[model samples]
Target: MRILGCSDICSIFTRKKKINTASESQLARCLSTLDLTALGIGSTLGVGVYVLAGSVSRDTAGPAVIISFAIAALASMIAGLCYAEFGARVPRAGSAYVYSYVTMGEFVAFLIGWTLILEYVIGSASVVRGLSTYVDALFNNSMRNAFKSAAHIDISHLSSYPDFFAFGVTILFSAALAFGAKESSLANNIFTVANLSVVIFVVIAGAFKADPANWNTHPPCTDEDCKQGKGGFAPYGIAGIISGAATCFYGFIGFDCVATTGEEARNPQKSIPIAIVASLSVVFLAYFGVSVVLTMVLPYYEQNPDAPFPHLFDKIGWEWAKWLVSLGAICGLCSSLLGAMYPLPRVIYAMASDGLIFKWMGKVNPRFHTPLMGTLSAGLLTGVLAAIFELNQLVNMMSIGTLLAYSIVAACVLILRYEESEVSEKKNDNTALTASSVLKLIINANKTTHATKLSARLVTSLVFLYFILCVCFTSLVARFTHDINNLEMWIIVPMIFLIISLVTVLFCIYLQPVSGTRLTFSVPLVPFLPALSILINVYLMMMLDIMTWVRFGVWMIVGLLIYFFYGVRHSDISVRKISMKSIRLDGRKNVDSPKFT
Candidate 1:
């Protein structure tokens, strides 16, 4: 009944739990590296590659969408590396949620788990809507109209009609997932292969037919006679490229889903890293190749969102190929939906088991050996939401949640790395200030020796400092100058770079370790890389519309309420510590300040 103090709150934040793999309660570890990689491909390479490519090209980046994809790829690479490091280190079920919980604390972990519901569950719903649209397109819109008429659920202000196919697929896949992981993986593998083959065929066929004239810039003009200069390759200029990158980022959501499967992966440390890297590489190449071909096959202005792939072929007089590509898209979307849905239940189970959600959801079905309640709950919710919401609304809401999660994972890596270094410094009794302890050796050596051979950390810090000074000098110059054509560039770009470089340099100088701790596969520049990843994620997140922030805020509030009310009371870790304290305090003199055993 005593009120929790600062120490108690800190204890909750700092608590670390080791997963017991030998326990009977653990999920099956049947997924191989190949299964994980395939899941990544299935999840990451879906509707984005097929649909987003042309839509972005027409509406935002024009021919410069290729650069947008590259920008997105870079952001994803930063996030992916952070994920690879944590996924290897933690090897748990909740992906970012587990990573945050283990490193940051229960509150941060609960928030992340809630955020992931937005990423995976809503992601699945968005994909379902896309799949339904594609199915309707393939079947001449009859099924959609029939369902809409039969139900006649009024939401004309929200969506055209209920997407019954979306709802139906969610149920079907939920049933499939209830069967077990192996069966779900098999289905994903088949659909993914079919999707990739179709993608390859499109890339190959489109290359031969691509016309050079299509690549030329055509500015927006009201006069039909004017054939060029609507805005050129970068119709919207540099701003368009950045905006396109923000939107295109949604395509790279899958690799992290691999992290969620860590509990089920065979040799997760090895498999998770390999799968994350391999899957991302494959998807990046696929996205790049498809974006290039899509732009070349048709003018950017002509690209359509509803059916970018098939419609392109249809315009080129290959009607049969359109239908074929449509079929492939349906398969791709379904596979993506499967990949997206697969992670939600595990996250729910992870959160529930931690007492952050309904405890009943944590229970595994005896027959299926899966989180049956979580699966059903997630599936039904997403399906219902998919039926009612517009596709753009669903898609627009996804990026902010995804970026927020990625930023947190990156932050966790940075925190964990620093914590590990601190712990190592405390534990290791080695007093050597020689060559063995690199930084200390530099400090303890003679001035002449120090002058001749500065430590690696010192050298790196100096280099970072130089860059920071240069950025500061440039910004000052830009601020004082009067002749510059683009005042915005001088005032904004240099100042931003200056801030980032200064932070990086300060971290390098202050956060250096007395002794380095190495891992088999750690991020190359520990804090720097993760910090950079966090910055990029935050910058991209800022580009999202106000509605996204509002929605994300609402989600966070709900998660906090659940954590304080249910999680605080029922937390397994907290309960264990409490019981231990009660026993240790038995008839203790300082009852109020009793020691924990």
Candidate 2:
């Protein structure tokens, strides 16, 4: 009856989901480490391997695109570690959503789950669209032209014609997932192996044709191109390489799909972390090798953006290799499509089972033991999106959701690392806070409930401060990138603030006692590693264009509305709390009454 009160509202929104309750998953634990690794590789090594190397080399970093991929890979690995630690600790289906619920609270969890749905939908749709286009091109664009001739619409954001092929592919994959988890993963493993084989072939074959001079020579350039820093290994200079790293960062986005299988992983504690690290290493090598061969085989300026590998083979008159590479690209895209769709339904099921969304969506199929309804729903939505939307319009919207999720996961890792566990909380509650006591605790650096609590608060505040400082520093650098040699007061002031913020964070993290709770896998350098992950993820998020922020803001607004209207009222945590309170009040009243006996 009093649920609408301000206190009640705050309690419901801020309540954290218990890890014990969340670990009781209905899904079957069928996935091995290799299966999970395949998911990561399949998801991450998709269209990017085939297309990204050539495009970034030609336009952004030139031969230095190899360095760009390496930088991006490093950043991705840091974020991947954060995910791995949480996966080992929580071992749930929702990935960041479940991690946040146990660490951050309910509302934040719902928002993350919502954002993940957005990321998967857009990512899968875009990949399917790309696959359709590739297949169409291979057949001389006959399919696309036929669709264009049949029913062309002149909408701005929508495609010129409906992409039925993309829609069909999405449905087909969704059905495979609904049939069973192991079945889908088996298919993913097959396609992933094929994809990797193609990458190896490309690297080995391209090596014989590679000319070292391509890296050293400045392809004939106009005066404007020269002035823009075009020439040599880094035709666009350090600035271009950094810019290309930002673009290449998206290529590494799919590795976190490994974390989403926490509920289904046969040995999540060890398997999830191993899969994340191993998969990331393999993906980085693939990207690094491909970029090297791509830039070396063809001059950066002459590289093709559309179908780089096939185009390279064509230029060299290697007709056989071109066909082989094309087959590999298709396999890669198919795997990526499956990888993207695989996680969406799992996140949905996690949210729904927690009563954050419709309960029916969380129901596991009796025979298949999969979230069949959720999978079908996700597939339908993704199919319709791929059918109507233009890829370019949808692509920019993908990274923001993922980056935000990564930042929050990293923050969660940092917070969880410093906070007292339940056992410690019971012990620490007895200690009273006083100025002298606080000072003594700080001076002693001994583990106490009070000291641990204080340290956690300090770490939380410092993390927020670090985020602000990163934003300021990144914005200032972007504004004055060209004039760095002639630094002004504006640049100097932000740089100092950023340095101080980071140093303070490090000091607080150093002094804090880490949580006693151990996991099979833990991120090395507690607080520091996760802290860096948060900073890097946020900085990359800021690198996105203004339009991306605008779209992200719109999505957040929609999620907020859903939370306040439906999630708040129907949440399992809220209902259980209310029922328990009512029962306690009734018992107290009976105790106060006269004894009937």
Candidate 3:
């Protein structure tokens, strides 16, 4: 029991990686703000712009999908700010993984890195699967038909036939990444430029066919006939808009890819924040413009869900434009594929270098200045996933991992803001928590450094606890909304507890002094903005189905096993600490004894 309760075991998990040691990266630093912005845009502006706008407007938000995009964009921007601040401060390869390691601990960092690998792998596979499907549709489903005829084998949750095309595309791009950062980034830039041009063309061309009457059209139906109510600009109402915003939120996911390239950037502090904001701005404009044009060019109900752009051009007697749009769609998907795959190797490298995973994965190719082996490994794994699995099976898994990562990054920003420094984790002095002591601590928080640090740490922990409870409370309400009348006591008690906790957290945060540590760029509004980001992320996560949670749990278990069995023993920090301790003991023994002359 004592062995199980050993402090050494507990301390090992909470040990943080020092940022100063990771400041200089082995990877080549060649990316500019433009290149990074291109990465973000290319990675983010995929099939969503071409398909999501039309589907969401037609089925969910009506013309209000415009508002849906705006709402989702706002949430994404808030999360992006948190990423920007961390990217400027830490400027490491692993997006959330490195950030969490520096601020949280090794255990949390490993879990985040594990989740990130899941996100990128699934994200890449989904992109390529979409690409294969799009191409098959363009070719009249010949490829799918051929595969179906040759080797159709459908499992319950897998593809009906192997997606060889998707596999080939994934491997090809992975090889491209292995060539070098600059080369891969150049290709991404070209594809991104082409993708943007297509977006501009769509907006311009569709604007000519826009009709204001479409936005105001009211279908003749009673409340019983139309659950969403009579058709208009907001045919689906506020609930529908919020739901659509949840769906649209996926469109803004790839922006964090910008943060993953910190090590590759020439001036990460300046360029990373700039790239994150710029790419998000560009991606939002593209989505918003397309949604507006899509709703305006035709009635929301009339829009096609699968291939809206090509069909729109066809409906309007522009057959040539359909082919052009199809070509653009392929380019966009290719760019998205590259963007999704780009981060996986870098994240693996970061984790591997920290001795959390296989150290061989961290090796940078001297000639290419890239993680060649890891790149190939990731590409092969993603390719196999794309080749064997259906897109539906892979897509849902991506969201849970991404939302969790985003939520953690937001939480990290909040914690880091109140921290005195990166490595300041000393235990606070034991003090009684009486009313007068609390009042005095609050009052003198800014006057005394000790008070400031102590209060900041105490309140930060409280805020985190409150945040967990808030998520639980929100999930409970959502789960039992129908039974609220009968469960009023259950609901009311928790709600009251949550309110009190929120008020206390806010008050403490306000009274506590912020860290004096400066950064070139930092998240403003501190606890409020980050707190909102956490709430939004939690809400969105709650929106995911139960099966997603199950899958996430399974992945987490696998990660924990690896961390305990391998990472705990082989960690570089643990090894260094042991060596330092041994050195101190040896010196102490020598000093204690008399030396013979």
List TM-scores for all candidates, in order. 0.84, 0.94, 0.93
Which lDDT tens digits does candidate 2 get at residues 1-597? Answer: 444788866777679988783446688999999999999999999989998999899989999998999999989999999999999998989999999999888988998999999999999999999999999988999988999999898988788999989999999999999999999999999999999999999999899999988897776758765642457899888888999998999999998899999889998999999999999999999999988898888888888987899889988899988889989999999999999999999999999988888889989998999999999999999999999998685577788889989999998988888786545545444457788766544443455533356566656766677777777776766667666657777678777877787776566566766677767888888777777777777777777778888887898899888888788868888888879999999999999989866
Q: How accurate is candidate 1 locally (lDDT)?
A: 0.76
Question: What is the per-residue lDDT of model 3 for residues 284-360, given as tens digits with 9 covering 90 to 100?
Answer: 99999998998899888888998899879888999888877878888899999999999999999999888899889
- Candidate 3, superposed: residue stretches over 4 Å from native: 1-6, 21-23, 421-435, 439-451, 480-497, 584-597
Q: Could you list the CA RMSD of all candidates, in the order they appear?
A: 6.6, 2.5, 2.9
Write down the worst ten-residue block by lDDT for model 2. 442-451
Q: Give the whole-model CA lDDT for all candidates, comma-separated.
A: 0.76, 0.86, 0.86
Q: Which run of 10 residues does model 1 get worst, by summed lDDT?
A: 445-454
> Whose TM-score is higher: candidate 1's or candidate 2's?
2
- List the pairs of residues colliding in candidate 2: 231-235
Sort order, TM-score high to low: 2, 3, 1
Off by over 4 Å in 2: 1-7, 21-24, 222-230, 421-451, 483-485, 585-597
